[model samples]
Target: MRLLILGTGGMANAHAKNFSAIDGVEVVGGVDVDPSRVEAFNAMHNIPHGFGSLDAALNWGEFDAIANVTPDSVHHPTTMAALAAGKHVFCEKPLATDYARAIEMTEAAEAAGVVAMVNLTYRNVAQLQKARELVQAGELGKVKHFEASYLQSWLVSKAWGDWRTESQWLWRLSKKHGSNGTLGDIGIHILDFAVYGAGSDIDKVFCRLETFNKAEGDRIGEYDLDANDSFAMTAQLENGALGVVHATRWATGHFNELRLRVYGERGSVEVQHRHDWSKLFTCLGDDAETGKWTETEVPSVPTNYERFFEAVQMGRTLEPSFRHATSLQRVLDLSMLTDRDRREHEVYL
Candidate 1:
């Protein structure tokens, strides 16, 4: 597979490295609005071609697939262009800024009959995969409740760098810069984590979003820190499970963490991915009687990058597909309305 990385941002490095490492895949080129950045990305990845824009790269048309590491708002147009050009696409999360655009992209990918997938990075966690497996196999015996959270201290700590001065960090805090704040950023992630781990879809959601003041003026040069910093959601799953999903950049002490706990009539499962490490625990059978949780060893699973390559090769769409992402985006869209109306909203995919 000849792959073109669609953006030269920080995430593009991971895309280039991972795809280049695949035996049958090659990172042939990179695209960025900044010529210098694209050139530097090509050099760093030992890529042969660099284009200043997606249009330029599409006109050249040498690559078989595209790794879309573009910003949340740019995913729609670029991905539509790639699909129109008959190229498979692996896009970053949130699919698009809103459900209308996301559904359009999803329909386009379907109509184009191409392999289109989203990079909901948490899907790579072995513990999350195992937890879902247990729930599906009835080991959890009908999930009744679940709680999931995506936490980061980037706003409070310099562990990830200063958000006040960095464009990369600031862009995520500004709505005009194509950001939906923590709700649109990490909220989609934990929402996916909760629903996927519970092995069900979200049926309804009630969300509350908050944006804490970071700077005195709440303005950082061209970027306005008006985007939400935190969001808490109450969701009802299709399997009759009630779940709480939330995310925040104000979570002090934690650099980056994703945790989910699913409770069922017969058993309970817990999965945690902190920093880069993941662990799984379960209370089942006799252990459930005593409420004793025992840690379990989970086998590793393929990353989203690997799965995308395989899906393209096999001519099949995979989970985290454009359609699935659009479904999640539907929930996210309704979440905003729920917050606005101060009431729960039913999710319709």
Candidate 2:
């Protein structure tokens, strides 16, 4: 598979490295609005071609697929263009800035009959994958409740770098810069984590989002740090399980972590991915009687990058398809409404 990496930002490096490592895939080119950045990225990855814009790359049109590492707002336009050009796409999360645009992209991808998928990165977590399998197999009989969270201390720590002066971090804090704040950013991951691990779709959601002041007068040059810093959500699963889902950049101690606990009548499961390692624990059979949780062996799974290559080769989309992402975006869209109206909202998809 010949792959063109879009955006050439920080995440784009991961895309280029992972795809280039795949035996059948080649990171042929890269596209970015900044010529120097794209040129540097191409040199770093040993790629042969670099284009200043998506249009230029599409006109060159040598790649079979594109790894869309663009900002949240740019996903729609770049992805649509790729689909129109009959190229398969592996897009970054959120799919689009809003549900309507996500639906349009999903529908267009389906109509184009190409392999289109979203990078819900956590799907690569072995523990998450195993927990979902156990739940589906009735090991966790009839999930009744779940608690999930995605936490980061980027706002309070320089572990990831100083967000105050960085464009990469500042863009995520401004709505005009195409950010959905904490809810739009990491919220999607936690929602997917809880919903997918519980092995059910979200039926409804009640959300409360908070935007904490990070700067004096709440203005950072051209950026307004008004995007949400924290959010808490109550969600109902289609299978009748109730779950609490939340995420925040203000989580002081943690750098980056995703944790989930699923409770059922016959058994329970817990999964955590922190600092790149993952572990799964379960309470089942007689152990459930004593509430004793034991660690379960979780096998490694293929990463989303590998899966996208496989999908392209097989000519069929996989689990984290644009359609599935659009479904998740519906919950996210409704989450904003619920926060604004201060009421619960039913999720349609």
Candidate 3:
């Protein structure tokens, strides 16, 4: 499949590289607002075409699919446009900053009958897959509780946005941009992976959000620092399980760590995926050493890029689709709105 990657962010480059490495995929053109970055990205990837905007690319680019790699703000519009044009799309997560807009995007894609998937990349993690299998196979029988977190130290200092030449590390801190900072960014991944692996849906959320690392003085720039840097929530699952989910960008020692443990009546499983290493532990109900944990091998899952191409080329439905993001979007939207005024919020379906 030939593709046009919108937005010249680092993720755009990653998409280009991943697609290029696929068996029969090509990055035909790229679109970015910055002309210099457009030229640079194309030169770096050796793509045959470049455009100044998505409108221009949609008008003239030769591609059957689009990779919406833009910021969270533009996800709704760009993806809607791509679906309207009858093109398949691989959009970034959160679907949109607004729940209504996310619904519209998913509906548009569904109406178009196009393969649309949100870039919930962690869905491809092998350990998470293994955990999901354990839950599905009843190894962890009747899950009763769960604890999940995605932590990173990038926002502790000011180097979070040093990689990309955009927003001065404050877009996430902006209401007009990110809406829900750490929650929307990485916390959504925790919600997604935990529920996904546990094969359950969250039914309620009681949240606590913090802005401990808010920008001060000259650091605010043009963006507002009202967005949260850390968030902790107690979630009640549809399966009557109480779970804790936490995300913080100021986690001092952690680079990027996603850990989840699901406790069931008979057995339990703990899965950890870190930037450096990953591990999964399980305990069967009949283990003689009652509280013992044994390391289990993680299942090897396929990459999203490979799955996306396969879905597009084979006319199959995209798992972790925009629909899934819309589901997660509601959680983020409510998380953004939940505060001292409204302490506990019920997760809608």
RMSD of each: 0.9, 0.8, 2.1
Put the candidates in lDDT order, highest first.
2, 1, 3
The per-candidate count of clashes, in order, stands at: 0, 0, 0
Per-residue lDDT of candidate 3, residues 1-349 (tens digit): 9988999887887898999999899889989999999999999999999999888988895898998989888898888888889999998887788789999998998899999988898887888888888898988788899999998887654345451235646676677665677887887789998899888888888788887635454246567677778888888888898899998887888878899999998888888988878888888778624788889875577888888999998886578888888888887777766756467788773
Task: Give the per-residue lDDT of model 1 (tens digit) for 208-319.
Answer: 9998888889999998989999999999999889989989998899999999999999999999999868999999878998989999998899999999999999998898
TM-score, per-candidate, Cα-based: 0.99, 0.99, 0.94
lDDT of each candidate versus the true structure: 0.92, 0.93, 0.83
Pull out the clashing pairs in model 3: none
Task: Tell me the tens digit of each residue's lDDT in model 2 across 79-143.
Answer: 99999999999999989999999999999999999999999999989999999999999987889
Q: Give me the overall lDDT of model 2.
A: 0.93
TM-score: model 3 vs. ground truth: 0.94
Stretches > 4 Å off in candidate 1? none
- Cα error of candidate 3 at position 265, Å: 0.9
